[model samples]
Target: MNVLVLYATVEGQTRKIAEHVAARIEGQGHMVVLGDVRDPGFAVPGTFEAIVLCAPIHMGRYPEAFVRFVTDWKTAIEAVPNALVSISLAIHSDNAEERAEAEAYPIHLQHKSGYHPASVHHAAGALKFLEYDFFKRFLMRRIAGKEGGPVDTSRDYEFTDWAALDQFIDAFAGQIAQP
Candidate 1:
């Protein structure tokens, strides 16, 4: 399959996940074009089989720029099998409300982005204190504390489950290969 993995990131965790996704697809003998949605330079070739959109959660939302980009090219995206992966710390929260917060973007994309993706993957994001500013680091730690999550800001917390991600990708790959 010809696949495009477009993503947006603030602290680079989303980018890492995108790379992992692309690598998994490539390992299955698929051609993958991984690009940032912020400045997607390549034209969407009409022959592509699938496209995967990924973005990190910031302030409880996916980047507006990415939303705009996808909206503007909805026709091209709709022409292929597609999936969306939303990365957020909220995804790790066992609380129903926190999980709802994590699903907000994917819900919006499904109903508003005008593209019906074949699948949706919600993955927990990382907390990279080393990449955050003092205020952000403090805020995140406090929020984590409230949620009974990791409070140590001296290091990082990665909630992503690689095995689960692989399983999701493999399932999507199967969908793309269907006649």
Candidate 2:
């Protein structure tokens, strides 16, 4: 099978997750093409049998570029076996409402873009304090403290569960391999 793993990232964690997804899908004996949605040359070549679209939620929404991409390619995207990896730090929150909000982001994106994915995976994002500017770092630390996440701004914290991600990939691969 051929798969396209595309992503839109801010602060870089979503890119990292997309790379990992591409590598894992390729490792499962499928051909994979990975690209950033913001790349000037990025295009869906119509050769992929499956796709995994990943994007992170910042503030309250996905990047405008990501929303635009999905809206533009809605028909082609929905024609294939596609999945969504919705990355958000709120997925790791101790509060149930936060987690629910994180899960609902993909739904909102679907409603906005008219691209409903076959499956949705909610992945916890990271807090890259080391990569943030002073203001962002301060704001993130405050939010982390309020959410019961690690508030140590001296380093970054990753909440992605690789094992769970692998399971999702494996299942998707299996679905694609079916007749």
Candidate 3:
């Protein structure tokens, strides 16, 4: 299958995840086209047989541009096999409320945008202290402190589970390869 790995990112973590997904798909002997939805002249979602869309949540929601992209492309995307990778720091939180909030985000998105992907994976995002400006860094530190996450702003922290991601890709590939 020809799969499109489309993404929207803030601070670049989601882009990195998109590239990883594309690589996994290609490694499974399928064709892959990776693109940032913000880029000009990105291939239309309708052209791909399958798609894996990645976007990060910031301040409790996806970037407005990402919402717009989904609203515009959902019809085409829903016609084929598709998956969503919703990245958020909240996904890895010990707090049950925070985790539920993280999980509900994608459903709310689907409600608003009418894009019901066949599979949804909640991926934990990174805390990119090095990339943020002063206020963002300070706010993130407070958030991390409250949540028992890493508080050292001198370095960034990542919480993605690579083995689980690989397992998901392998399973997805298997599903696609079956007759």
| TM-score of each candidate structure, all chains considered together | 0.92, 0.96, 0.96
Q: Where does candidate 2 stray beyond 4 Å? A: 40-45
lDDT for each candidate structure: 0.84, 0.89, 0.88
Model 2: how far residue 106 lies from native, Å: 0.8
Which should have the higher lDDT, number 1 or number 3? 3
Clashes of 3: 0
Worst 10 contiguous positions by lDDT, candidate 2: 40-49
Assess candidate 2 and give its TM-score to the true structure: 0.96
Task: For residues 25-68, write the lDDT of model 3, one tens digit per residue.
Answer: 89878998988888826566888788889999999998888888
Query: What lDDT does candidate 1 reach at residue 89?
Result: 86
Angstrom error of the Cα, residue 178, model 3: value is 6.3
RMSD of each: 1.9, 1.5, 1.4
Candidate 1 per-residue lDDT, tens place, 1-179, comes to 68989888888999999999999999988999998877778835355789888888888677887777777877888788888888988888989998987877777765766756667899999989888999999999898999999888789989999899999999988888842
